[model samples]
Every structure is written in structure tokens, then in C-alpha cells.
Target: EFARAPGTSDYAHNTFVDFGGVTAKNVRLTANSNWGGMFNQYGLSEVRFFSIPVFAREPSPDSGTTDVDVDVTLSFRAGREAAKHDVYLSTDEQAVIDGTADVTTVTEASHGPLPLDLGTTYYWKINEVNEVETTTTWQGDIWNFTTHEYFVVDDFEDYNDYPPDEIWSTWIDGYGILTNGATVGYPAPDWNQDEHYVETAIVHGGEQAMPFFYDNTGSAAYSEGERTFAVPQDWTKHGIKALTLYFHGDPNNAAEQMYVKLNGSKVTYDGDAANLTQTAWQPWNIDLVGFTGVNLSNVTELSIGLERIGAAGGKGVVYFDDIRLYPLFSAVVGTFSIHPWTGDGDSGISSSKTYTHTGKFTGEGTDGEPFFAGNGVYFERDTNRSGTSWTLTGAANVFGTTNPVTVADDSAALARSFFYGDEDNNHPVLTLMGLLPNTEYVTTFYTVGFGGAGLRFVDITPGDNLGYPTRVDQNGVGSGSGQLIKHTYTATSTEMSFMFDALKTGDSWHHYAFSNEAVSPNLGSN
Candidate 1:
């Protein structure tokens, strides 16, 4: 029990106490006596408790922010009782939470204009330190942010002639191996009149580059440099879409097929083979989709190689540098329905094959059977189709966020099964959310009608009066029930709206499906 001074009054004003610091599950306060010497006569008005001010709060890039610059400095407001700060940072979230991250104690409240890796998320924390206080350390809350997605795969700047750091240490070339004619780096005597193992003179955006010599002759018809990753990398993360590499030709090099392989899945460069003999640096950008059949999320190996296209034997050296991965751009392409999708549940009208959905069905012959396409698309049903009401559905995986699709509809149905708009103005408006801004997308809509005459007509618009609405009537083609209607539009923000207005009264909008795809950027050649 603790006591105050003899002159301290208990009932005159609010009481204050300094407990220094505490770690407890329960705290109790007992009043022994009042100032008037009667404990039962006095009753408490209010009681409060306060914690220690030991948190370093308000971080700069704010927590969980995206698109932060790669060269960013982290800063935080110091705690009220802190004399110094211990900053911990790492790419691993568990390491930071366990206090095992790279740490530095500093008098300042900031940590670095750091040269962090691109397209990566970093976790950090600041522990307020005060050696003189009763509580010497106060653990901080973990904060994280993602950097801009544009990181280098390799730049050849770290290669050296020393043991285990040589250019050939990580990059396996065809030196002693048979049936391959690739040689990496120069010998110690100085093939290029230089002491370094890397080519410093023919570098691209760096101090050095790999001198990849290829000799495709006799039984050895190809030359390649291969590297196996110690840890498999996920190319699909952070919205990565393309891989780019810079190569400088020697003008005397052999004319061969240039290609790259990811986990043994090869993608040949589509540019002219003569670019290998141009004596200038050229960029080759390959869409990740071109490396088909490879698990892009778990790529374990990479290879850059050249194969002789003709009977003529040739040999020369080429310089490569600055291999990098890039994120998505503002471009979209074609659209199609996920296959095995038909009426009666085999491949019938469904919104998505990948995303999960919840729905209620009434009188039907398998009207809302689920389908799986393995592609990153989702579908949802708007059960309230009687009045003009908008409803949102959840989507995962593709957008990396919740609430990706919304639908607004008005229609009438038979036995709460077959649906059609009685009024001319009643229709459905689809809103796609979490899309890349300024990106163009082509969307396909499937309209199925149960009417035998197939007399349903509707006008579909891609956006709000962006252009003339495409007028279409049900063709009753697919299994004698439906046809597809398509539209293309550019998203101005994270959200875009599409309208499907009934062009004729008594027209059916019975079952519906929607699909969208982004246009593929120029791959392999650019």
C-alpha cells in the first residue's frame, strides 16, 4: 500500500499518482479513510487510469501505403519520455516483430534515405528508449509499406574476379560441359586488356556487364548461361507483368536465335536476329504470359541462350546487363467465356469461374450451377432483381482487394425463376471496381433468354454516354438459349460503370454472364 503526504487532501480535487510503469492483469484501489476521518461517509465520484507515454507514433509514409518511392526515408514522432530510438527494419514481417531485424540506435527520429529494393514490401518499427527511466524500453507497433514495383533482377555490378564472387560463380556457362558452347567472363591474362572478370567498358546503366561469349559450332549447336535461384521467386506478385533485359551486340557476333527460359519454359525473342550484331544496346521486353506452362509464382531457374539457326558455324561475344521486372500498364485486350461453360451447368451462363459466389435459386433446372475455369475471374448473382437497387459482391486473388463488382437491376420474374424487364427503362448496370486507372478493358456480356421466339432486345453501353450504345437482340444460339454481347472502355479511376438498358418491353434478361481481359502488351520483341 502507498500513502500520500499528511497535508494532501482526498476530497478537495482530483488525485494524481505516478506509478512509474507497470505490467499487471488487475489493479485495485482501496480507500482506508477520508479527510474527515470517516471512510463510510465518503463516496467516490470517479476514478481513472493512464498508461505510460512510450509509443513512437505517426510514421511518415503512413502504415500500409502503396506506390511509395524506392528511395524513401522513414520517420516517426518520438515518444514523450524517449531520449533515443531503436529503429528496426527488414523485408520479413516476423523478423521485425521478433526484434531480430537489422537495428540501429540513433538520437534522431529518422532512419535513412535508404536504397531499398523495388517492388517489395518492408516492415519496420521504432522502440522508444530511455536508459534513465524506470521502464527502459517500450516495444513499438509494427508498420509496413510497399515500394514501387520496378526492381532489377540482375545488373552485374556485384560480379568480381575474387573467389566465390566471380561472374561464373552464380551464372553457369558451358565451359567444361559438353554439347554447349557458352563461355562467361575473360581469363586472368586480360582478354579485353582489363583485370576485371566483368566487362566494365560495354556496360549498360551500370559499371559492369557480363561478357557472354557464344560459339555454336560442330556438335555444340547452342550456347547458354543458366542461373538457379537459391530461393524461388514469385513473378506474379506486386502486379508484375513484364521482364526486360538489355543486351549490347559486338557487330561480329553470330546470328542465332535469342531466347530466355523460366523454369525450363522457353520464350524466344521475336526481334530480328541481326540485332545481336548491331554494336548497340537494345532492349527486349517479354510478357510473363509468354512463358506458358511455367508456374510463374514459383520460378526456380532462368536461362539466357542462343541457338544456331543455320548450318554455318559462328562465334562472338555479347554484353548483357540490367535485367528487370516491370508492373502492369494501361492497356487491355480481348474477352471470352471460361470454357466448359454451357447451359445446364456444364458451361452455362456464370459470372466468374475463379471467384467464389453466394446465391439463392428458385424454380430452375440448374440455373446457378458453379463452374471452375482456373482463370482469375469471378461472378456473382444479384437476387434482388425486382426494383432498382445496387448490390456489391466480394472478389479475391485478382484485384488483391475486397468489393470488386457491383450490380444494379430491375426486372420481373415467373415463379421467381425466369426473369425479364417489363418496363423499357428497367435494366442492369454493372460496375467493376479495383481496376487499374486509365487502363482500357474489353468486357463481354452473356444474355440468356428462355423465350422460344428469342425476341429480347437491349442496348449495351460501355460507359456513361462515352459512345453510341451497341444495340443487340438475343440470338438464342448457345444451346438454344443465349448469345454474347461485348464492350470496350478505358477506366478513368479505380471504378468503371457499364449499362444494359432494355430496348424493348417484355424483353428477357433471364440469365447473365460477364467477363473482362486486359490487352497484352507487345511481348518478346519490345
Candidate 2:
């Protein structure tokens, strides 16, 4: 049927031809003489043969929204009836529709969840067509949106003005004031210098810092400040690790100390006299590797603490600024292999399969992910005690186990060495990051008599400390001998690391010797 045939003998305007899902290759229409039998004639400005170009875009994330995932779906309303659709994505505004440009044609209403960069903007368009490539029914308009920026958790800059009720809603704490990188000083005695609390024009990232003056001379008090914010996107998914903040204050070189509490839990990491003694702004970072059940997506609070009985008679000032909670050290922790007994003990054995196509570690199994030792941008250990220490073992050592062993050799094999080897009475924690968000991964290893070896997974953005791999302080080696120790982790980030330490003397060979550790992601496939 003809598309523009309308009102007999009169000129046809605003007319449309509906083929009704007809598979037309070549269409031809014959014209007839005018009804008055006058010489046949007609006038039309445009002759359009719509072969099903994309007519409209479907509902999706609105433009300018923050904290969007890297993988997003592109949908449409009109393109569903078409045989195929072409998708184009670009950061450039003037993305063109040409034969030689980047495009993908698929037979679906929605285009790929193409991988996108973090904290970046993108432009996209869709064009619809039929199976037999004859015409373009419609061309979609250019649409754009920005991805999430999970790097800086807190800058203390997005608050209302300070006239009593105009302070930022980020915290509830001791005596303090937010300044626009101003030279803020507190009034105190001669021994009490307030310059340490003043940030002046120095800032880590943004234009604000909280210069807190703690005059703890009256009574023994706890110095703590807490914040209420949105759940930070999983930083591990973005290849970030550890939570960092900038601090400048006088050192508490004695028994007096402070600590950082995340998600209403106390970690082994705390400050000594050295932490408070710093006169210049420095980044204080804590490893997020082994905090129990920590997920960044559900993060709720962040806080800092100190003891009023410590140095300066608890009469000093500390400046806090830009308390960001993410670091991108994209890595996975483990030996990559589906089966450990199948490869050489020294060489890291992973699957022969490739992924989105980049570097290949020991990747195998259904999901094509490798066995993780631990993944993160960087791994770190912190302790306030002078003699405290932590280290990972070199390689797997063969040892006959009194306990039952799985896989290859019936004898047990040691994968890594003792955690927190020295100063049995102090706190030592190892933290790392780099994990996929809302994704599941598993860790299987062997340990013997590993006591006080607490584990916690952390949320990187805004540092929610109560994430995956919950606190397991006294988990034992399988069979109480050198056996396979396995635990599954559903992380809030790209990759997750952990911390372990010993608080007391070991029971013989029971100083937390871990071996044959394999970490794998839950990729569903054969």
C-alpha cells in the first residue's frame, strides 16, 4: 500500500505509510490521473523510505546522576520491531554516523552494557535498520551521561555556610570548625600551640578542612568524630584499595593514642605518639584487606578517635581534611589455577583462557577468574607498637601433614608464611583492595593454629568497614592440620584484601602458617 495517499483529488499532507511489519526489499508505487481527469501531476518536498531506523530511546539513568556503575544497559522503545540496531558510543561530542566509524549492529532492543570509564562522560546514539539493508527507518538523537567518581570520599566542601546551623552534615564530633583553607588557630596556653590545627592555604584536594582543637585537660575522654553519608560505591570494583585521610597534629609519643573506626567497628590499626606529632599534612592510609564482612556499597559511617589520657595532657589541636576512602591499585591476591596440583610449584599456573583481553594471571574455572592471593592497588600493614610486624610467605613448601590434605600430594604444602611475626602483644594489620562490586569470589587456603587472625572486607568509597569476609579471629586450618581452608566473598568493590595479626605467643607450629591458598571468582560457566 502507498504511504502518502490521502483525501481524493486534494493534496495529501502529514500522511504516513504503515507497512505493518512487512519485509519489503523493493517497493514501487504507481500513480493515477487526477480525479478531474486533468493531466496527471503531483508535488512533494521529500520522498522518504523508512526501513526502520531507531525511532526513540528507552528509559535509563538520567543525565548528570553520580555513582553510576561502569556497566550500563542501553535500551530503546521503537527499535524493538526492527530486525537489527546499530550502537555507537564515544566521549567526543561530534560523534558521526558513517560507514567507517565505530558501530555495532545487534538484533536486540537494548545495546551492550559496554564498559565505561569512571568519573567520565559519554555520548551515544542508535540507528535502526531491516535485515536486508535497504533503508534507515530513523536515526536517534545523541544522548549523554557521566559515570561515578568514587575516588574522593570526603572533601568537606559540600556543606552549608557556618552561622551555627549551617555546618556540614558529614559528622558528629568533638570541638571543631570547618574552614575554607583558612589559617585557623585555637586559643590556649603557651605549651598548647594551635598552629598545628590550622591548615592555612594547604589542602589535599578541595577547599576545606576541619581544624579541631582538643583541649582534653579536664577529664579522661574519647576523641571521636562520626559522619553520616550515602553508601559509597564499591571502590574495589574500580581497582582501588585502602582508605586514606590527611592529618596534621602534634605526636602522642607515649601511651596516649588514637584510632580510626569505620562502620561501628574497631580495627587493630590505631595511632601512637608518632601519629599526632606530625606538623605537616600527610596522608594516613589503612589497608582494607581483612576487615570482617566489609562492603563498600553499604558503608554508613566514618570516624576518628583518640584518648584524653595521652600526651599534651590531651590539650592539642588536629586538622582533618579531605578524608577520601579509595585507592586504585587494581590487583588480585592468589595463585591463578583451577587445580593447584597440576602445575609446577614455583611457576604461577592459570587457565589458558583470556578475558576482555588484557593481562592473564592464573585464571581458570567456570567464570575464567584466577585463584586470588589477594587483589588490590597496593597492600599495606600498620601498627602503633614499635616492634609489631607483618609479611606474606614466599612460595609453597612441601610438608607432611598430620592433618588430611586435599588435591595432588597427600602431604600438605605451605603457600605463605606467618602473619604478624613479631611483637605478639601489639596490633598489626595488612589491608589491600581491587575487587568487583556486588560480585562473588571465593578464597581457599590452608592454615594451622592461626589465632587472633581476624578478617574483614571493607567498602572503599567512604570506607564502610563492615563488608564481606566478616571478622573471623580464630578460624582454624582445615582438619586442624595443613588442610584446605575455603571461604566465599561477595565484595562491594572490584577486589578485596584482608588483615591478620597475632596478639599472643604461638602454640608451637601454630603461629598462623597458611599454605596452598587459591582465590577464584564465581563466574558461572563450565
Question: Which candidate should be chosen as best, given lDDT against the real structure?
Answer: 1
Q: What lDDT would candidate 2 get against the real structure?
A: 0.44
| Runs of candidate 2 exceeding 4 Å displacement | 1-83, 86-129, 134-151, 161-170, 175-200, 215-218, 230-241, 250-258, 268-275, 293-296, 308-313, 327-526
Model 1: per-residue Cα lDDT over 1-526, one tens digit each? 2333345456444466666566554777776776666346545555577875578999988999998987798999998899999999999999999999999998988988887766779999999999998778889999999998676789988888788999888889998877899988875636456568788766555578898989988667899999898999988765678887877776567789989999998999776777686544456768898898999889999999998898876788888988888774212221112121233333222333221122322233343343222222223333443111222222100111122111111111111232334455566555665556566655555544344432444445545333223334454343234344444455567655555555456553443444454443321110
Q: Residues 1-526, candidate 2, lDDT per residue (tens digit)?
A: 2344555666655657788867666887676644445667755555787664336566366544556677888776656446777777777757644433478877776765766666567776777776554554557667777776545676656543333322323456554432111112332323354242224333434555666545444543555666666645454564456676766554442233556766776553343454454433444557766455667556776766555454444546677776665533222221111112211232232242111111111111222233233221111111111111222222112233344333233122232333232433333332223444665444433334332222111111112232211212232222232323333445665433333333235312222222211244444221
By summed lDDT, the worst window of 10 consecutive residues in model 1 runs over: 396-405
Relative to the unseen true structure, what is the C-alpha lDDT of residue 67 in candidate 2, on a scale of 0 to 100? 69
lDDT of 2 at 487: 35
Worst 10 residues of 2 by lDDT: 377-386
